[model samples]
Target: MEPEAKWNGSSDQVEFSRMSPRSQGFTKLPGQKTCGKSVLLFTFVLLISAALWGTLLFLFITRYQEIVQDLGKLRESCVYHNDSGILTVIGQLQETQLNLKTNVPQLSKTLNKLQEDQTTLKSKASQFSQQLNRFEEDGTAFRSQVLNEKNTATQAREKLQEEIQKLWIEFQRANGSICTKCPENWQVFQKKCYFFGKEPKTWAQAKYACINLQGRLVSIKSREEQVFLNRNANKKGSWIGLRDLDIEGIFLWMDGSSLNYTNWGRGEPNNQGQGEDCVAMRGTSGLWNDANCRGQQDSWICEKLATC
Candidate 1:
């Protein structure tokens, strides 16, 4: 059957009635057009998404290459600084080793010199000790020799004293055996004899007369002899043996003996007139006076040993 077609008042739409089966299958439906439009819009959106992803990937690759180059430069700078510091430390160690080598020999020489000085001091000390020992031995020997000499001198002196004592004893025994006596006109006292002359004579004449009688002028030895002579003087001035004929004021006995005792009167024997050289005993006072040897004449006394 044939279908009827009607035109509507719209410009793009048409209405159709029932048609044959073959024509109906070939004609486009309104719902099929709408489905095609939707598929086109979905394809356009997918293409835009793919283009934006491609641009982002290209920017990331370029920035990654630049970062890798900067890291490489920094690592090279650090390696260069480490090499310079190592070389400086090695140079300082070499300088220290050279200085140690230069100083070692001088230190060794100073040590050796000190050892030599110590040895020399030890030698000098040993020599001093030996010399001191020798001096001590010599002192001991000298003291022993002096002791021996003193003992020898003492023994000789003792023997000489014994001999002198024996001789004195023998002399006394010989003198005692003799019967000693004084002359007829002489007086005896203490183993000595004295004679008083009454005739006044010069000192020289009196001295000669006494010598002729085998006697010397009286040399009074003690107070006892002087007293005895004084009594027998007969109250007259008598010449004694004392005189200063050799040197003025130095009285000596006629027998050449030293004058040990004196009985000088007041201001007497004063070298009177520088001419009185002979001594006389005053009969009244028993004191002695100096008189002129040749100008004055006086009575004299004589002395002699007894006949033994």
Candidate 2:
């Protein structure tokens, strides 16, 4: 509150005033109001641009990371899928091997059975071959034996036939005087030949009478002689070929020859309790029978001593 001072309107004072904000020139500066507005606008624009750029860079990095992560996950998934596929392939292989193992024993058993069957067939074939060989051998032996037997039989038959022919010829040559019966005065000389037409007598008496005359009763050596004697002997009875003087009462011939010829009638020479020392000729039946000796007889033949 000082009292009124003196006023001096000088140039310095005017300049100073003008420099102050209260000066008119300060107020009239070009675009001063719009400068603050322009600064604010520029700041806002820079901030907005920086934020947009940062956002864009962040978005690009995030998108790039996401793509990279997705690629990695895809690779991992591919690896896992490949490993799983390999494992599956391995599992299939193992199962195949297991199946093969399971069938091996059965296959071996089948092979063994086949081998056994082959062996059995071979054995059967061998047996059949042996049987065939044996059959052939037996057939050969049998043929040889049959041939030998046939030859032997033929030789024997030929020999036997020759002997039979010789015997028949000898029989024919000897049959003339030896097989004939003679008359009363006549006498057969050989093979028990005899004469008839004398008186009948007991066989024993006839045999004694012949013996006293140095002859024997008629003794036969052949069927022809027996037939001749049977035809010539008298009807009552006469001496014949047989006598019982040897051991065990067996009949023998007076000529010391074997009694090989016999023509006994049925039931004849069945010696009774009485002695049967001589043989008698049966006239009707033309056979011989046993009888007692020491009976009478008529004419008889005396056997002469052999001259040769």
Candidate 3:
């Protein structure tokens, strides 16, 4: 058996070496530095966060400044508007004051002139009223005077008419008949005076008869003659010296004088022609009318130059 082959698998001889403590630990080959990778990743994320925060802060500050500038501008505009309004009001007040100052004197002058005109008009009106009052007083007095004069004249005229009427009545009454009331020495021939014995005849015949005796029919001239003849003559209608000529209504006396006085009965002398050719007295009334020349035998009236 060869001595059991030396069985220790030893290739080299063992030697004991001594080492330092720092170098004694087994060290893994340098690990890939995974901790450094984790740190880098964290730092990158922190930097991005800081940049985003700074940008947001800057945007907030700019917006705040813009808001403050707009507020200041608005306040300034309000102040400016208030000042403009005050100035406008003050200017208007000044213009009004100036206009009043310009017009006041002119208005005062016009008012004074109006007062003067009113005074003049009042004076004229007062004068006119006084004149009118005087005229009225004068007119009233004149009317009274005229009325008094008219009354006096009317009374005088009425009295004269009454006297004339009384005279006419007295003459008529005395001439109505022949009586002892007649004149003395008068002989009654048919109630009229005659020369003792005178023949009674017609108007034409007696006219001729009287002519032969140098006398004519009685001519009545005055109121005394009428009264005397009326009292003494026969009172059937008697002839008068008055007669109408052949010309229709032309009456005249035998003396060829137109009769200015005529005493005729109402509507008498209608000239009933045929045989009525003479003018006669209608009785003692002294009224006359046309009648027949020989109407009737009443009396004869003769006229002669007065013997006594």
Per residue, candidate 2 scores C-alpha lDDT tens digits across 122-195 of 99999999999999999999997998788568646644654564465457656642334333455554522244
Q: lDDT rank, highest first?
A: 1, 2, 3
State the lDDT of candidate 3 residue by residue for 1-308, as single tens digits.
Answer: 12223324575644335444555676445554777788999999999999999899898999889989998998899889988998898999899989989988998999999999999999999999999999999988988788867745754664465456445545655887223232344343322343211345667776766556555566565666666666666666567767664556787665455766667778887867575557777556756777777664355565543221
> Higher TM-score: candidate 1 or 3?
1
lDDT head-to-head 1 vs 2, winner: 1
Query: Among all windows of ten consecutive residues in candidate 2, which has the lowest summed lDDT?
Result: 299-308
Candidate 2 global CA lDDT score: 0.65
lDDT score for candidate 3 against the true structure? 0.64
Structural similarity to truth (TM-score) of each candidate: 0.43, 0.35, 0.34
List runs of model 1 lying over 4 Å from the truth.
1-175, 178-180
- Give the worst 10-residue stretch by lDDT in candidate 1: 158-167
lDDT for 282 (candidate 2): 67
Which whole-number lDDT from 0 to 100 does residue 248 have in model 1?
80
List candidate 2 segments past 4 Å from native. Answer: 1-184, 189-193, 200-204, 294-308
